[model samples]
Target: MSGSGACEGLPGAVRVVAGVSGSPGSLTALRRAAREAARRGGELWPVIAWELPGGEFHAARSSVPPPLRERCEQLAREELLDVLDTMFGAAGPGVPLHALIARGRPGQALVQIADRDTDVLVLGAGHRGRLHRLLSPSVSHYCLTHATCPVLAVPPSPLEAHLATVCRRNSWHLRLDAGQLTEREKPRGRVRDA
Candidate 1:
């Protein structure tokens, strides 16, 4: 198994918590996930986890400006919703779509929310070699490992398929580094924007 979190759960109607990073992989994955959500009439939960420079560098700075943090969170929420609209707006109108932005680790935040009712978690694989530490880090790896439900690792456009490849290629390295790994190696299939 991949170096994902230690917990695992059940699978059902495919309620998905798809991470949105606005990258090609993320976009493609989002479209596929949205369409599936539409098909199953399940909730498509979109999440964005972003950390500011202060949070990255000045971790001890409790005096971080409220507005700055708020703005970043707002932007995260907006960007996720926007991506969903731009990719699958047709099915998005009250399509049970929900967008959220967290202030800390993306993977952890996404997992916490998805753990409630999420049956399937979706995320675009990262580029090859980039999955290596300090390079193309993916919180999806964490979700894939920890969530009790079945995880859906969607492949992106051919131009974007490298993420998953690289993720798998770097799986050993990640595990050595204590990075979380997912259960299955490959996803089911690719979903186009509809």
Candidate 2:
């Protein structure tokens, strides 16, 4: 679908898709994506992903009621729009912005959009807690591995930058000491501290 209208095609030659979740990292990603789009003479497509509440499953839908489900969907849409407004501001003039809300896992939603609608995909590295990164598969990671287009996983903000650096350094040394790999082998992304 088009950014603001019917099935009409997009206005630019290139499309930059960014995933936004109302977090600082998402905001960072949105800004970076917008800039990239502008630099490349393209448009920015910001997608927000939301999942149905656990109780809304088909088996339980009758008990949950339709009104509640509709309300939940409405809330998700409003929240996503509010985030776009906050990040892009009222006039948001320079770069054309197309906002979309997809219902599914964030990574999957973004990947689908990237596969069909973009030239480059951008994402933020959310919450830099060492344990968090190690235990979970981040949206950025998912998209990096799956997106058909080029993916840009922006590094964490200044506050988390040092932590990432320390983690990378420590991991590099550990790998050498263990003799599991050679100095020529480099980790794909920032390594998390164990």
Q: Please, what is the whole-model Cα lDDT of each candidate in the order they appear?
A: 0.67, 0.74
Q: Could you report the Cα RMSD, in angstroms, for every candidate shown?
A: 13.2, 11.2
Model 2 per-residue lDDT at 184 = 60
Over the stretch 19-96, how does candidate 2's per-residue lDDT look in tens digits? 988777888888899999999988788887776666225525546567875776677778877887787678782787
Residue 113, candidate 1: Cα error in Å is: 0.9
What lDDT score is found at residue 158 in candidate 1?
Answer: 69
- lDDT top scorer: 2
Question: In TM-score terms, which candidate is top?
Answer: 2
Off by over 4 Å in 1: 1-14, 90-94, 130-132, 161-194
Query: Positional deviation of 110 in candidate 1, in angstroms?
Result: 1.1
- What's model 1's lDDT at 154? 80
Q: Taking the tens digit of each residue's C-alpha lDDT, what string does model 1 give over 1-194?
A: 11123223233444667778998878877877777787777767776778875565575556677788677767776786678678766655355665666667777766776675546678887554634756645676788888776677886586455455566568756543233333446657996789
